[model samples]
Target: MRGPWSSIQSKLVFLIAGISMVTVLVGFSLVTERFAQSLRDSLENDSLSLAQRLVVDSAAYLSLGMAGQARDNLLDKVVLNSPHSLALFDEQGGLFAEIERGGGQIVVDDYRPESAVIWESDWLHIYQPVEDSLDQRIGTLYLKISLSQLSHRMRAFVGVLLVLLLVMLALAYFLARLMQRYISGPILTLADISRQVRDHQNYSLRAPVKSSDEIGVLSQTFNDMLETIEQQQAFRDKVEQSLRIKEERLERAVAELQYMANYDSLTGLPNRALCMDRIELAIRHASRTRTYAGIIYLDLDHFKDVNDSLGHAVGDELLKATAERLSDVLREEDTLARIGGDEFVIITTDFSSSDQIIPLVSKVVERFEQNFTVGRYSVQSTVSLGVCVYPDDGDSVDALMKAADAAMYKAKDVGRNTYAFFEAEMNRMAVWRQQLGSELQHAIDRDELYLVFQPKVALESGQISGAEVLLRWEHPEFGSVSPADFIPVAEHTGLIYRIGLWVLEQACEAVSRWRDVGLEGVTVAVNLSAAQFRQADLVEHIAAILARHNVPPQTLELEITESMLVRDVDQAIRMLKRIKLLGLRVAIDDFGTGFSSLSYLRKFPLDALKIDRSFIMDLGKNRDDTAIALAIISMASSLRLKVVAEGVETPAQWSFLAGHLCDEVQGFLISPGLRESEFISFYKSFSLDEVIASRNV
Candidate 1:
């Protein structure tokens, strides 16, 4: 039966089935969505219209100024027409009329005076005000209709689809059966013989050939294969024995190769690749556990003189001895890797505080103060150590490595025999951020939080195109704090939600003031932190802010990083679309720095892609950076999005981006972030040529 289905003949069946399935799926999706939408629209519209008509129809009866009981009785006109449960309430919310299918709690979010629709499970609940000729509210009309009809129709449609699918499948099966020929019987027989021969190890067996077609050729080939197998059986056993021996040797070689790949050949310590993997794993674990992971980067001072004077052999011995000594000091879980010559890194697997790692750093630094003996040669090698803590200094393995390396160089810079925390300054920063997090609650109250506006220049016109809102903290002790210092702290402490809202309100306030004084068409971009962006109430909050300030949404643009979309693409898309619908422009900031997909880029309702400053900073000077900037511009163009180059400080950067037709450029070259008054002054007195010649604002 499968003879036709098992060969080229089955192609037609598959093609027909696939086409039918795809056509049905596509048609069903389109029709079902449209049908559901129509049903919803019809339900809401009809409910509202009916409620309004009933309100008007009963208004004449209720206007007679009869007793409350008489008005209640008069509202029966409403129940007569309404198929589902309803209640007519007077202006004071007194129940005038009532009808119900099943006893259900009369629930509405709030007593909305205006008309609104609420989807209550399978019921469409619509409420509207009963207005007289003078448009005064006489009463409120509430009506609900069952959505059961929609479900029924959808089920019926799905049933029809199922029947259609079954019919197509049956037709395919029938066609396959009709196409199957007696020729398949011989081929099946040959298959059975071959299977049996293989199962029983009876290679002497042969397939019988009955025709002179392909099947005949297959049968003859099968016979020849069996004969050849039988003759080669002994030789195969001998070959298998040889292969087993070789396999054993290969396994040992593979193990050795694996060891050599990951471990330093001389020191037997984990090499650069394995060290990176270990550090990355530790970083990930620390992030999840909310603890600190540390890297202790050690470099021997003047060890190159040991290499040149004492020779490579001594250096190798010294490295191995150093590795052994370091391994002895560290716990089993900690990694001591010889990533380079005279440069070693010890990764703290897990630590609750930076203090735990500092002891290890000190021990390593102190250990190197002693003399290292290698092959009858004594050498005094003082090691400079740099320590970096996770999350505070950096989050990633590469970042932590670089941070630790920089600290090590710093230690070397300050005379050799000492250790330095790369984030030593960061320790103070951490304190400041922590202080800000706790004190941010009072920032709004103390009137310390203020915003600076950074102007973005349109490359084409060389005039102010937009301004990004930069928040500053003016703590009593600290005169002015950069957003870079406090933003992350706020995010971590969950104060960003409040700070973000404040920022939005402030931005809207600024925009409102500007518009009042005839500074219209200026879009103020405000950055949305990840935590704030993910809030369910962000859209409503923003709408309320815009309304409160009497500022149009078009005047305010929300700048979101690509990371937000990367976390939850679908949710981000929905949120961004909501913002788009609200008439606010959205731009993906630091575009090239994130792992956002190209597919997602189009899905995002984005107005612009702001190329990361790092890429823009070296444009024209660095070929790769220039290429990346150009590529981003081209992609944004192809996607029908505007491209804004950020951190454009140099004339060369400005010119290169202008040449590429970048939509806007923002950086110190245009102007550093300014006070609102200063920005307004600059905005009034600035142009492309003016700023370039003056060097800065």
Candidate 2:
């Protein structure tokens, strides 16, 4: 579909060359045609003139009557040195004389007159009349000339035109190729630069500026645009990096704030707020699923003692270590949180029964009981735990917490270092104790409690030498609750002060009653709790109790435990001296079981040491128990204090204690805890003669 002039350079060159060739061809053709016409006319003229000369000369020959030789001689003269052929004919149109000249070649027939002036194949022929002196139609002359030289000259002119055409074509091609390179090279370079920018993102590149033409200006403009793009890209990268760093710093700050809000900084455990939230969630889940969930609220039993004896730094370290151990033992589903100092709450879900929870509680207690080495000091601590199950104990968060707290106090009441599950009866007792605690404020005015005496007879003699005064609760609706139950309740609720005073007054009153009944010399022993012993007015309270009961201070014995003696020993010793000044005996109760310093034991004003029931139970079975008993008895004897073996259930145990010369024995084997009237009957039946007779063996 392309023409000969498709390319711009080719088209322009073809147009210029075609115009020049057409002008040269038209001029040469016109000149060549005119030259041919002129040559033909000149040849015709010369041929006629030569014909006339031949006729004149031939006439002389014909007049002399020798026509043949004269015609031959005349023809020879006319044809010689001339490039023509001649022929002579008679007027009759018959062949008369024919002369072939210029190589003796005849070009036409003599008889045909019309053929004399013929030009064919580049040869001219002529015919004319030849007349004698009389001027008659004597002969006709014909002449022929060769025109081959003229034809040869025309062919040479055509060859020169062809040669000029070839030269112009070669020049046109060279100019077209040069023009194509000049125009397309810069455009191709710009196209390559644009492609590089797009493919490689190399904005720094620019087109080459090779000339001051329009294309070169375009290249310079493109370079300027690329420089602008590079600057903008660099600015964007810096902004993005700065923004990223700022966002990262802000995120880190927010994370630190969140950690401080939800967790304890030192222990890394959930704080009070987080604990309450978890407990609330657990309660809601239990309500929705109708499953049992338990909350264990624990408090370290002797944390205060450790804090006082050791420093706060060691106490803090122990707490941190305890948190780690607790986290290790608890299940992933359970939540253990530290709600306050020395207090924690553990929430457990999906428990089927109390048995499932016992092992967990035991593990916690056992782990805590392990000695903690804090800053080169070894300290032993135990936890008292109170557990409350959902829906079984309470339905609401506050109610569950209150129930668990009351159960925890009950654990402390039984003794420290134990776990107790909340019971419905305990809930009622908790309410009752709350009410009684309020009522106890006026108990000194209202006589609500009293004391009863049970005689402690000597094992060897069966003689009644002492009596223990046990406090009894006389509830109006309950008729009479045992001292074993409410006495602890009283002690925990701080009602023991009023109750203890009342027991002291009644015991003094009983001493007066026994004297009136002729049993005056029996000493009355009263058990005292640590709470009562720590009272600032403990000595005054005891003095007033004895004075109001009309009982001699020497006849009243106040029994205290070794825990009370070791905890705040300086204060305990001072209080003991005050009690001794009131002329009352002080016996260390459950003596050998507690952690007491032996050097400090004899420093206190003590009347007796009561061996615990655990030692007495194993006295018949365990040699260790026997040796411990013997050691205690010897130590007490050396200190001039009486040794009493409690819980002697079998004859072997009684015989063992009697053989060891234990001062007194009390257990179910002698008599179950007797009523006042039953105790009196048993005491009368007990005869020293019978015991001595038995002992004599």
Candidate 3:
């Protein structure tokens, strides 16, 4: 039973059927008990009434003196019509009368019954007393009704009720089964659907709807919920897919941006920004390990020649090839970066000493010295490399780069195609250069810098054609420092702009002074360093200074070295043109020492070309120097530029340059640089004729 009822329908059917069975049993029992009670009451009432009637009639006859006949008649009537046995007794409590008929018997005895019997096996007894008119007892009357027929009727009625109860129970069972199917079936199906949805993720399934009841409405709502859930799940999947694709795209974009930030686009090597970062990291690592690192700053020797001859495309390919070669030569731990157009940096990590770097530097130089074939253009290139080591050259990245750059320039000074390690003297010179730079800034501020005029004498007549206004620093601490020591420092520190301005002011002042002293038509040439020439405001500054000083622009000549013109020819030419537009003279100072061609010489605006002091110093000792000096004079004369020879220490050197048809000469041979007052006194005492006579002797 328990197993069969485990099903929801079976359980519900059993529960409802059991309750209906109990209700039917209780109702039938209550009705049967009440019906039996009513039948017993009716039978007793009818029997008593008949007995009393007989007693009354018999008493009336005795009172009227017809006792025997009336009694006989009454007995006969009661006996024939009554459904009971009848008996009568006199007042003596003795047997008197009895009636028995229709297969029933009645007997009278000399005893009175103690109790009345309503139903018995043979009869149901009813008793009554006979009374006179004065209500005196006369005789006793008794009747025994047969209860067999009533027993049959009661049995039939009980049988009928039992059958009806059985029929009601059967009908209740059928109705209970129908109700269970109608109510529990849809609920059980919904429960199964809910469990399946939970376990299998089957949101597409709907509960079965059976009828238009509460259960049916719940099933419809559950199906609507499943539909909503399916729609939401689909939307979530689409959103997840879109997010994944967007995330992948964002990741790729970030990677590309990172590459762009750290690498050179064309060469595919690390750029300056990345190089500096690596240098900083290497410095920290070296400091921790108590080791040294090396940096090699390399600039291609004739890259400009390639770029000018070949197109930029071939140039770019050549640079790429160079990068690849350098990377191949370097160790895995080392780093190489392309810092500029033709500049590259190689960082060597964990180096033990300076000697450890020499081999690497040599390999790089030798490799570049070979020919490179870049798309049908065979090119031979050399690199000037400068090496700076950790803790020896510099401790910081900026210091290291500066030291390496200075060493690279030193290598170029010794001739290209070589490498130079930073020396102790170079570091010392760096410090001194810094100190000089500081003092030069102070000197400009405090008005300690002054210009001294060194007269430039005409080679033919020894007459002062012009004077070179040379800068001198009378430092408060160092007293007097040479321009050879501090001029480069000023140029390197970018203090040349201020110092150059001061020089122009002083030169203009001196020109005014010379005019006040009646010295007319004498030009004062002021030397301009490369850094000063590159100043964007240089021409404007000079024009402003000249105009303010009330000095003729022609009398104030700005002198620049050939190296300055060779560095950036186009920009230098443009600057020179601007300066010439200001009505100022531009001359090439220290000529024949840099890579200046005849074409450049002819193209540049110039008033005079001064032979470099190195050639003047070796005038009589080296034939090459003598020839170089002669060639420079001839070239300047051909170009219609006045030729001036500087650094003449001996009279013989001056005579040589004068005989070579040099226009002007300035050096210690004439007079050492002097103060303004002393120079004025010397000029007053000395004559051009006397100086020429002494030179001829």
Candidate 4:
């Protein structure tokens, strides 16, 4: 929308140039006028001196009674020297002799008898009275001169000023353009960003703030506004979602299965009771029939707002319409069920791939896009769907449903009104994770936690040096949830701190029991999460736990990953030194997988380095992994620290470690994590000679 002169840069330059021009012109005019005045004054002074001299000689000639001599004197001095015409007059004011230069006629105005100079247009006139030697007046000299030379000088001065005026204006404009960038650059950038935000609705873009000036303040304010908007939008979504989740949980908890009727009472579709049976049968049928089974988990998006704004009757009608629309869109082979409030599930027709189910889900999504008309009110609602294919997403009903449910929530997470397929990632199981987290919260209070110990054997003697204590859980419903699935959730939710303390106490108790049975040298290593490692009272807590359990300090090993110490090496060193002071063993777990520097490693209070399992998994097969493993072993040996190779499963891997003189190793080849009784038996019956003999074979 900017024109040629509309830009700030253009206007600023022009304004400066215009002011410069006017300033230069006015000052130039004043100077030239003063110079012209000086020139006229000089011309008058020179003319007066010449006329006085001529008159002096004329007066002497007239006194001698020789009028001809006086006239001759006038011709000799005046006519030869002056460019302007000169005339001599007697005491009676009559012309005696006349001289004219340039061959032009001379017209003289009435001249004053006293000494005077005057300018009439482009001419100058000077009058001076002539006097004799005795001071008696004989005649008056009248001189007239042209002002052409003075006029020429004045015109030349004006020409120089005009040139200077142009140069000053150009310089002023150049400076204005140069300085205006600092002012206008940020403003223009903001303007461009503002337009983009308006057109695209992308609030993530921010104007750069380069200074502490007003412009920078403006940019900061703009970015703050965008931040507030984004935060508010996210908060609003979370609020609505939380409200819906709470309401659903309450209603679903209260609702019961009706065994007599398999149909939902409200919509006449299959209810939860029939839905579970159908989903299981569909899985079995798909397996028997040799095709994939698809399950689409769907629910109304932001239906709580609808129910709240309108009455529950309107909300119920809307849900019924949604059910009808979905039933019409799906194939006859597909089983549609109303699982819960505003929630539905589909056991789809047999398919070869997830592609076959795509069309049905798309139709259902498209159908929901149209408004639903209730009796007196029209309601708009959209659906989010999660699609899962059998034997791919999962083989069982619970897993498939969990996958579909997770994908559905993911769809809702990404602005809803769309469909998503189940992705194979721990973080993607939105529905399963919610339940896992909720169950994990009560896991400790309900006494569902237990311990598993993986033993580390010293290679030379095959004696159990230590075992890394691991935590485990078996949820009554979810069955045997892996630590990998719940650990990150616990970390994010700050449950790790509590979980870590509990694990510490459990490991210590196990340590005390082992010591009681005369297994005092068998140290148990408990992995410390970052939260536990950073605890200000970590050393104190360990001391207290050891004292209370009556276990030797060296019997408990604290395994810390490299990442924990990378942030504050000095703080970690201090903490480690304090732990060492308490006679507790501290070993770096998974040594090479993080950002720990060799210099930093050298500075830490030493104990041991456990080579990461990744290297050991392919130790002899992969040269790069082999070199890294050997290098870590060599480095640990050089530092005089114990090197434990984890995940050493094969004879070739064990032979390589034994040949290289590795201190200790722990992996499935030795034993899987065992119960305390199993561990006690394994430790008592372990044979190093047999293991070495097997490796040789």
Please, what are the lDDT tens digits per residue for candidate 1 over residues 1-697?
A: 7775566446655665667667767877787788778877876777777787777776655555443543454345444332477666668776666566553545543345667899866777778887778888887777767777667877887788778767866775665545444456666688788789869988878877888888889888888888888879867977998899899889988998999889988888899999999998988888888888888889887665455445578878877888888888889889899997888999885777888887787787778778987877776778888888898888888778878877876687688889988855644544555577788778889999999999998877777978999888898987787776677567546678888898898889888888877677889999987767767789999999999989988888899888667655666788898999999999999989889878989788999999998897778879998888999999999999999988988887877887887999899988889988898888888867877987743
Better of 1 and 3 by TM-score: 3
lDDT of 3 by residue, 1-697 (tens): 5688678898888889899988888887887777766776777787777777877777766455465676486666664333555666656555455565552655455235432545666556766777788877777777777766667777898899889988988898899989987888888888899999999998889888777789999999999999999899888878999999999999998997898788898899999989999999989999999999998999887675466445578789989999999998999999999997888999888878879999999999898878899897677778999999997888999989888876776676588899999876666665666678777778877877877888778878766777788788888888889988887667546677777787788778877887899878889888877666767788888878888878888888888888677655676788889999899888888888778999988888888888899999989899999889989888888999988888887778877876778888888778777777777776667776566567667
Best by lDDT: 4
Q: lDDT per residue, candidate 4, 189-253, as tens digits? A: 98899899899977778999998899899989988998887788778879989989988977775
- Estimate the lDDT of model 2: 0.74
Candidate 3 stretches greater than 4 Å from native: 1-22, 34-322, 329-363, 369-382, 385-413, 420-591, 598-611, 614-697
The clash numbers for all candidates, in the given order, read 0, 2, 0, 0
Cα lDDT of all candidates, in order?
0.79, 0.74, 0.80, 0.81
RMSD of each: 51.4, 21.2, 9.2, 28.8
Q: What is the TM-score (0 to 1) of candidate 3?
A: 0.54
Q: Can you give the TM-score per candidate against the true fold?
A: 0.41, 0.47, 0.54, 0.41
Clashing pairs in 3: none
lDDT leaderboard ranking: 4, 3, 1, 2
